[model samples]
Target: MHPMLNIAIRAVRQAGNIMTKYYEKMDSIESKQKGYHEFMTYVEKETRYQMIAIILKSYPQHTIITTDNNTMHTGDQHVQWIINALDGSINYIKRLPHFSISIAIRIKGRSEIAVVYDPIRNELFRAWRGHGTQLNGYRLRGGMVRDLEKAILSTNCSFKMNPNASPYIKIIEKIFTQCADFRRHGSVALDLAYIASGRIDGYLAINLAPCDFAAGELLIREAGGLVTDLTGSHDYFYNGNFVSGNVRIVKALLAHIRVK
Candidate 1:
């Protein structure tokens, strides 16, 4: 593993340990809504703090961008860390055990490392640019479900926050008709990891933050899959939309989306 990626792995694991300490007592964690269909808890805040400390201890000069509503940048830097200390907060609060800690390192405008750790399953999904995606050190080649009719696609219901979900709903309805099935896992990071591991053939969503897909995007691409925004561009970091999968499935999914 690249030295930076190794540091990231250590960071995520330590953070996962912190989260797991609170997992069993999450029901008493005190929570609030961040927005429509969104939730946050004190656990997230504490975990983010510890994770940031771990990363900075190793590379204090790196820039850090996080979804905790915190952004820090200083000095000349070629590397930046994008993180979601706790992805799938709702699932975590609901005791679903499907949440994860996501961390991705972007160097000089290009993503070079990614890690998503599911504490419940003790599964770690990781990738480095030009290196294969791995699950607990085993390399993954992604899925081969090219035929749209037989592919399983995953998405999130965050469209509820959008003024009009009809257009997005239309896209889902169309996909349901053509694909074997679709899922809304509530964790965009895990959804994309599943895509890379071949557990799912594709994933799509809109109005997501950079922290939501940064790690997953690199994992999918490194695992021999493709990722892009609805516009078929690789600029999802700014656009906050995604459609990722094997080349054939992504193109097929894109053909069905008629975003107004």
Candidate 2:
């Protein structure tokens, strides 16, 4: 294992311990609203703090970026550690046991290593650039479905009085009619990880931060999957609209997702 990846695994496992602890005392936890339909809790903050401490202890000069916009720039800007301490805060708040911690290391603006740990299920998904994705030490090879009609797709859509809700709904309606089934899971990290693990055939989401899918993106790609925007372009990283699946399934999905 790479030294940096080892440190990341340690940091993520430590953060998982914090999550499991707070999960047991959910009633005593307090949360604050950060934005429209977004919540943050002490658990998320503390987990990030602990992970940062562990990481900086080894590489104090590396840049660290968190979902809360608290960026730590110590020295090197070429290497960035993007973190989402808690990916599914809504699920965690509601005791849904479907949240995860996502960590991705970008070296020279390229994703080099990634990790996504689910505390509730004790499942750790990881990938190192060219070295394929793994779940609990087992190699993953992504989904095998070659057509949307036989594929199980997952999505994360915001429908709470949003201006783009109409187009988003239209995209979903079109895809749902063609796919085998659709799931609206709360965590994009887990959804992508599931795609890498072949548990789900494809995924779609809109308006997401880099921390939400950075780690999982590498995982999917390493596991032999592709990630693209709804328009089948590579601009998902810029537009925050993501679609991912095996090659054929992704192309099939893109045909039905029309946005203007």
Per-residue lDDT of candidate 2, residues 1-260 (tens digit): 98999999999999999988877766642433343133346678789999999999999999998884468555698999998899998898788889999899999989999999999999999999988899999999999988889999998885455676877887888788898999878999999999999999999898888898999999999999999997788887678899999999988888777533
TM-score of model number 1? 0.91
- Backbone clashes per model, in order? 0, 0
What candidate 2 gets wrong by more than 4 Å, as runs, is: 28-40, 68-70, 258-260
The Cα error of candidate 1 at residue 41, in Å, is: 2.2
Which pairs clash inside model 1? Answer: none
Candidate 1 at 151: error in angstroms? 0.8
CA RMSD, predictions in order: 3.2, 3.0
For candidate 2, which ten residues in a row score worst on lDDT?
29-38
- Give the best candidate by lDDT: 2
Q: What is the lDDT of residue 150 in candidate 1?
A: 96
